[model samples]
Target: MQQNNEIPQFDLAEQIMAEQRKNASVRRKGPAKRVGAPNQKRKVEPLGHTIKPQPALPEQEQIIAEIVARDIKKLCKGNARSPRTSGF
Candidate 1:
């Protein structure tokens, strides 16, 4: 029995894939650029005249407002129970 010392040869498909990988690595060394459409600077236009924002309400007033809103919501709800009219 005789053993060969030569390196094993890759098949045609394996050779193509190896070549592709080698080419890909070579390409990765350089900075990549976009394929199409040159970048344009967009002009930002102001939408109408900006109105001055009103000052925020005081903390105490905000709390009172929230309470009033909640009570109003409860009264507006269709499922809210009405006071019993029958005398017990």
Candidate 2:
């Protein structure tokens, strides 16, 4: 029967991995948990803006907004998309 070098190789590999992990750094991000309901809560506001209710508008504004959105879609047919529509 013949012995093998595999055991020492395995030990060395484990030691290298442990050392690397000890020296490595990682960046963490975002909230640890959901803060609030997506639709009901506003995202954290930028500087100078506070979380506030969207204003109440006359019924006419809704229709005008829709019409403008459609015109924007038409005008944007070939342009680079804004972040709002591309989602990143």
List runs of model 1 lying over 4 Å from the truth.
Answer: 1-10, 30-49, 53-88
lDDT of each: 0.77, 0.70
Which 10-residue span in candidate 2 carries the lowest summed lDDT?
25-34
Q: Per-residue alpha-carbon lDDT of model 1 for 1-88, expressed as tens digits?
A: 8999999886999889999999998776544553656688788998899899887679878999999999889765634465543333
Model 1 residue 47 distance off true place after TM-score fit, in angstroms: 9.2
Off by over 4 Å in 2: 1-57, 78-88
For residues 1-88, what per-residue lDDT tens digits would candidate 2 score against the true structure? 9888675435878898887876673333347743655677667867986789787677778888999999898767735655456523
List all candidate RMSDs to the true structure.
12.3, 15.8
Q: Judged by TM-score, which candidate is best?
A: 1
In candidate 1, clashing pairs total 0
